[model samples]
Target: MKPELLAALNAERAARRACVVVTRLADGSQRLVREDELVREPMARDTLAAPLAEALRTGRSAAIEHEGEKLFLNVHAPPVKLVATGAVHISQAMQPMARELGLDMVVIDPRGAFATPERFPSVTLLAEWPDEALARMPLDRYTAFVALTHDPKIDDPALHAALRSACFYVGALGSRKTHAKRRERLAASGFAEADIDRIRAPIGLNIGAVSPAEIALSILGEIVAALRAERVAAKAALVP
Candidate 1:
């Protein structure tokens, strides 16, 4: 890799941006493709869009033989961030599990009593309001948002921010009736129906969970499902 290419790649990684490096296998030539630039550069984008996007989405490299020209795509994506709002009992169960999955976990709550370092020992606890903290956290496509507070004052604002951003997953803990009411509130607040639909309310997979631990397990399972499901579906779509 050239010094300039490495520098460009490092810059993208620092900015938490997604990119692909295309290599001509025959000659070992290389060029970088930033995700944002794909749309503006039509010829290259049109030829490489499908594989480039797949590489970006899955963070996996791919090789293709197109028009007798063999090419390789090397994908680079930032680490995943899991933001759990509300330092409730479920977080105690979920935090470690999230860490075990290698996700950068941040527990957010304005209630100092709950968001204490003791409550989340060895975890990154942010004792700040959801909106302000999330603004600084800088939610992106690699982030997942979970609202466990069940309090509109806390969870709603977080959802608003996550939904507006490119966060890959958004889940909220609530019953069907509670989510219906929440939906009304969101609609009243100018959120379109589609935006409201983005929330996976009644969060966690349907596993008949009772204890906080069980609920946490279910939620993590659902989050994993959400993360990997799109890649599988997209790959299937490309098949004949």
Candidate 2:
């Protein structure tokens, strides 16, 4: 890697932005493709465009033959993170599963009674309001935000932040009726219909989950689905 290219790639990684280093094996030529530059960059607009986009989206490196020459694509995607609004029972159950899935988990709740260290010993527990805690964390495109607390005061602010940012998944725990009310509140607070639609209310896949553990499983399943949905679709498109 060239010094300047290495510096630029390091900068992107520090910013937690998705980037790819493409190397042409035949002649040892190399170039960097950044997510923000994918659309406008000339070099990325040819046959390499699709693979570069896929590498950024799926965070998978690949060696492929392009124009009779071998090219290697090294993907540098930010690690996926799970940020929950409340340290409730469901959040407790989610801790283990999130870790097992390799997701960096964070629980934020202001209630002293629930946000105890004993309750979340293995997780990054922030015993503070979601807005304040989230402000310190980088809520980027690789993040999955969940508002598990039913309280609007707690969940709404986090939802607003997630919607305003580029979180990959934004979910909330509530019934349809409860979500309806929440939608009304968000709309009244100046959120567009499309922005509100991004939130997966009545969160988790519909598997008739009853217990906290079961609900946590369902939510994690849904999060995984959201994370891979685009890649899955892209694969299906190539099946023909």
Candidate 3:
């Protein structure tokens, strides 16, 4: 490989992006492709084209070649964001749990006393209401939104926003009665029952949690369960 190409490949690796290198074999009819640790030798360029295109389309790594040359492609995807829409005590424990799970966490709250860097040292603390704060934060398929405020003024707006977006998880901390009230309010706010149903309310597993830390643990556990279920569903859908 040329120095410039090697440097670019190193840069992409350093950035933790997926990359694929395609090389043409000395025999003009064949090609060699490498992605991560997997390698395919003597593959015709035409034969590899469809899979390569599909991989690139899915933001994955692939390789293709023609003649006696090589090329590398790196797939770079932005890090997923985990937005916790409350700076309450549970959030204090939750943020670190999310970080431990390798998530990029952002804590949002309107109260300065609650949302502080001192409390959430590694989290991106936003001292703004959910509606205002989330307007600046990007919500996508990879994002998880959790409402820990248990306050309509805070949790409602964020929940509403998350429901409208493609956020992977949307959970609100509350009891069964509180969740019923929330459903009513959401229905009144023009959200359909199906949409309101997407929220994991009474938010967390049925672990009978009574303390802040315990509640946080339950919520994170439920989140992991939901994510795993989604992956399973997706995988099942992809099966022949």
Candidate 4:
């Protein structure tokens, strides 16, 4: 890698943007394809883009046979981010679990008492309003946003942003009745029915999770399941 390429790669990493390093197995030549540029950048003949896009979407590096040459698509997706729009007990339990799964976690809360380093300890705490905090986060396809606060003032705004963006997963903590009210509120706020449905309410799998820790596990499980399902769907699109 050249110094300039190294710098470019580092900058992309810092920004949490996706890119792919394509290496030709024949001569060992390599090139970088940023997600933003992939649409416009031309590739060598036989190097179809569907596979590369799929790899980046799934964050999986793989070797593909392109016109008899083995070209390795080394995907460099941004770190998966978990932005919890609350500093509640569930967020605390989720913090350690997210870290264990290699997710970059952030806890957001406008309440000073809750959003503190001492209380949450060892995680990034954003003690600002969800609208302000989410505006700063680069919510993308690799990002996951969850509304654990259950307070519309905070969770609603954060959920709106997640729905508007390409964040792969958006979930909220609430019962069916609570989510119905939430849907009404979102509809009144100008979100279409389809858009509002993107939020997985009563979040996590229905595994009878009662305690905060178990609820956290269920939420994480749901998020992972969604991610895996998305990966499968993306790959399935390439099949003839």
- By the lDDT metric, which is better: model 2 or model 4? 2
RMSD of candidate 1 to the truth, in angstroms, is 3.0
Candidate 4 Cα outliers beyond 4 Å, as residue runs:
41-48, 230-240
Compose the digit string of candidate 4's lDDT tens values, residues 1-240.
567777888889988888888888899888878887757746533246788878876688999998788999888888788999889999999878899998899899999998988778767899999889877875888888899987999999898899899988999999999999999999999999899989898799999999999999999999888878966687899999
Model 1 agreement with the true structure over 165-190: per-residue lDDT tens digits: 88989999999999999999989989
A best-first ranking of the candidates according to their TM-score comes to 4, 1, 2, 3
On residues 121-219, what C-alpha lDDT tens digit does candidate 2 reach at each position? 878999999889888985888999999989999999999999999999999999999999999999999999999999997899999999999999999
The estimated TM-scores of all candidates read 0.85, 0.84, 0.69, 0.90
Q: For residues 1-240, write the lDDT of model 3, one tens digit per residue.
A: 556666766676555344444434343232223343233444434555556555534655434443445544444443556788888899888777788887788888998988878888999999988888778765776678899887899889999899999887899888789999999999999999999989987789889998888998898888777666755677899999
TM-score for candidate 1, please give it: 0.85
- Judged by whole-model lDDT over C-alpha atoms, candidate 2 comes out at 0.91
Q: Model 3: clashing residue pairs?
A: none
Error of 1 at 148 (Å): 0.7
Alpha-carbon lDDT of model 1? 0.88
Higher-TM-score candidate of 2 and 3: 2
Residue runs of model 1 more than 4 Å from their true location after superposition: 42-46, 57-59, 231-240
Number of colliding residue pairs in model 2: 0
